[model samples]
Target chain A: MKKVYINSIGSISAQKTFENASFLETIADYNDTVLPAIDPVYKDYIPPAAARRMAKGIKMGVVASKIALAEANLENVDAVITGTGMGCVVDSEKFVSAIIDNNEEYLTPTSFIQSTHNTVGGQIALGLGCNGYNFTYVHASISFESALLDAKMQLETEEAENILVGGVDELGAHTVKIHRLINHIKPEAVTSKTVLNSKTSGAVFSEGANFFVLSNLRAAQTYAELLDVKMFNTLEIRTLSKAVLTFLQVNGLFISDVDLIILGNNGDVAYDTYYHELTDKVFAETPQATYKQLSGEFHTASSFGLWMASKIMKSQSVPEAAQLNTIQTSEVNTILLYNQYRGENHSLTLLRHVEV
Target chain B: MSELREELKEKIIEQLNLEDVAVADIADDDSLFGDGLGLDSIDALELIVMLDKDYGIKLSDPKEGRKIFESIGVMADYIAEHRTK
Candidate 1:
């Protein structure tokens, strides 16, 4: 099997991460129950006529994918895979609301067409004229990992040389309101610095797009080698440690072999114990970092964690803002990311530094 | 007649999400589809909905839309003649 390498990354998160040169140097602190992704100049990446019909999710996904393709120095890829929890949700809401208001009369097709889950992948393919394999995974918390796994398998068997994979979700007004009613969103506003300390029952909901180009051939701009990815439908807290160890062992790694651990701690008091189960016992000595506090929690939020892991592996330093513990590392050669949502859809992704 | 033409221009711009366009940019005789205004099939569907909802004109034959929607003057004249509302 061929080894898969992460050649480049693009992210549009709550922070100003669209510019790849800087690594979380400036943080946008937010004190809100829900955080919206910071917007980029859409015209720069897309034409106005083409962008006119796009929702926020589509714009972010298209721009982020463009950034990744540019960094990989490719005009197009062999495949495009995308994952999203809610696809173009704003348009979905608009279309449904219009139906109710008009009594099922005089409906237009734009909203209905753009609201499909595969629209992002389709739009990216249309923009590049790439007619190769295109797929979208709607699995809840592990959506991004599922997309990554698909890309990894194709690259391993040499079925594809390069693939563009991404995860994206945009906040919708009606969706946010309903989640708040069900206590899935934080009841009170929490600032970035206070997310981990929020001690609340729910997480601060947010939206973002994180994309990466994976290839079998390493290049000068390669970020990290994607070692492995594993997902679980459900994992009990008691067996969490065993699962971690078994995952590492399968990859020919021990707990100590991990140089840094990037965890998905979204400050949901009820479920964060899953992460605590590992940090408290299995990997106490390992340097640790967390990203949901900065990116905010979404179904595909784990994609942001992978992006951070790739960045740390390339820079060999951890930003103080993302540090989960005071422990520092001399070299970040290998990193593991663990993420879950509402105590389910657990995923583990391992990345390693590429030897030039 | 002029009032109806202006309303049609505004409606087309708003309905199609022509964010970069202005009311003055559209001339009465300018083509709505190919080279003049640069709209495509989707915009034709939106305009069909607009004609039904706003002017109470239901187009039974889609081929007729090609001629009626050729320009702003054509659309306004068709709507003025067939509108029941």
Candidate 2:
């Protein structure tokens, strides 16, 4: 089987992640119910004509892919895979609202065309003129992980040399309001420093796009070897630890061998306990870290967590802002990332530092 | 004629969410795409809808928009000749 490595990564999140020099140096502490990405100059990456009709999610995904490709020094990839939970929600809301408000008369096609879940992947392929393979997954929280797994499988099977895989979510006003109605968003805005300790039922909702250029060939800029990625559609809290152990075992790793563990604790009082189960029990000694506090909670926000893991592996330093526990490792080599949403769609990713 | 062109620019800005651009920034004969205003395929779709909704000119294919939306001058001319509403 061929090996897989992350050649490059790009993220546009609530924090200033697009400019490579900054690493959450100053975060937008939100007190509102929904947080939007700290957008880059879209015109700098996307042409005006092509960007005219793109929804926020599509813009982020396409711009992020461009940044990742530019970093990888490639113009096109063999495949484009994307994950979006709500899937072009800004357009979806626009179309649906138009249908209702206009009473189904003279409705335009722009929103309908942009509302498709695969539009981002399609637009990326259109932009790059790459027609090899395109796929989009909309499986709620695990959508991004599903895209990652698909890209990894293709790389391992030698079906594609380089693939662009990404996850994106955009906040819609109506969607945010409805989620707040159900307590899926925090009752009030919480700062990044206070998100985990908010002790709220809902999370601090946010949006972002994280993209990676994954290839079978390792290079100088490669972040880490994607040892293995696994996802579960439904995993109970009791089964979570065992499932993680099995995932590590398949990768020939033990709980103690993990130099760092990144958890997706999104400040949901109801579901943060899932992380507590492992952090307090099975992997107490492993240095624990989390990113949702910095990035905010979205269905595909775990993609940002993966980006953070890749950065930590390459830099061999974990940002003090992300540290979840005091346990420190002298040499950072192996990193494990665990994420789930509202107690479902759990994922565990194992990454190993390359010697070169 | 000039009012129609100005209206078109405002409609385009509003419909396409050109949040940073203003109607005054657009010249009547300036290109709607590429160098002039940097509109793209997505913007073309928005213009297509404007043609249909406001002027009652329905374009089945997006390619039809390339000529009609070349500029505010061309768009207003096409809409003047083709508008049913």
Candidate 3:
């Protein structure tokens, strides 16, 4: 019934993107397998008392939501929807370890209380003092897309005017060890500039939180209009291109209509072929870009992709740090973002430039 | 008994993750819940677990926690009287 626009964006990534004024002007290149999100002064956004018990995931999520809300110039929203693949993994690890270390005798309540998947959403609502609809999706890589879809439905149906949606995941020591054992993380370090073409077997794992304020009511701060979003549990490499074309067509767009394509190519030789299906064939001529090099490969890292798309649309320039190809576009009106994790949970999101 | 009070303050600060607070900040009779130390119900549960784990003092009734955790002085007194370890 109504159109949805990305009114504001906030991101806490491996790169310095928390401040809205600059967009990748100075990229942080790292030669590491696990890129932790750059820290913001958490005390600046949250009081020391409230932040004392929070793990990094919760802090990042809370601060990112606050940035988005402030950018949107709203004190409260009707709903808060968050998508986190490993919800509060640090706290969960702490709670579980305590269970073992103390023989289940002296488990504290703080870690247990904060370990739930919806804790970020609950904390945000709690901080805002807003008793409203809050939901969290933990469907691996498509988690962010799921939250976006839910928020979009409510906004389009006029159920909510403004909604705060975000995706966050924090690195857990044990989880990273397990992933390393399974070869889910890269064997060796790769710099940010070289991660995409290293042709590695596994991704450079990372953690981040990216949030946005989505609203049906457009304002001067609107970044882009959310056109459509599609997700799949499993996609055959052969059918990936067809899915992209179909998604674009459904949104009344064609190959030429898409001004740029943002791909989640995490340099995993085993799975990056999913993005190659479109990049090499269907959308080969389209200006192409990738972000996993800069953001690393977390489940909801696609939220960072959405953040990049919004900034590109608003600023009308694609940062060279994230550019995957030499192709250039004079005007970036429509952007298609495709992302997946280890050949599963594929998501396609369409965003169009909003003239404000 | 004064030694117990100092130990209790250290433990409370460490257990509740009161990073900004020092041992001196928590006066012996200062309130631990509302405006004094600004702890809420969650911190109360942490204190309960701390008492059970370190002092071997298990509190069964939550209402009893209101009086017992009123301050570092009260918590140390309760633990000194009831602690089995």
**lDDT per residue, candidate 1, A221-294, as tens digits?**
99999999999999998888999999999999999999999999999999999999989888899999999999
After superposition, the stretches of candidate 3 with alpha carbons farther than 4 Å from their true spots are B1-3
Mark the regions of model 1 whose C-alpha exceeds 4 Å error after superposition: none
Better of 1 and 3 by DockQ: 1
- What interface RMSD does each of the candidate structures achieve? 0.5, 2.9, 0.8
Estimate TM-scores for all models. 0.98, 0.90, 0.96
The digit string of per-residue lDDT tens for model 2 on A263-314 reads 9998899999999999999999889999998888898999999899988988
Looking at model 2, residue A345 earns an lDDT score of 91
Per-model DockQ: 0.87, 0.44, 0.85
CA shift at A198, candidate 2, in angstroms?
A: 1.3
DockQ of 2: 0.44
Model 3's A-chain: what TM-score?
0.99
CA displacement after TM-score superposition, residue A253 of candidate 3 (Å) = 1.4
Cα lDDT for residue A90, model 2?
91
Winning candidate number (TM-score):
1
Q: Rate the local accuracy (lDDT) of all candidates.
A: 0.94, 0.90, 0.94
Give candidate 1's chain B TM-score. Answer: 0.98
lDDT of 2 by residue, B1-85 (tens): 8889999989988887787789998888999889888877766766777787789999987788888888999999999898999
Which candidate, 1 or 2, has the higher TM-score? 1
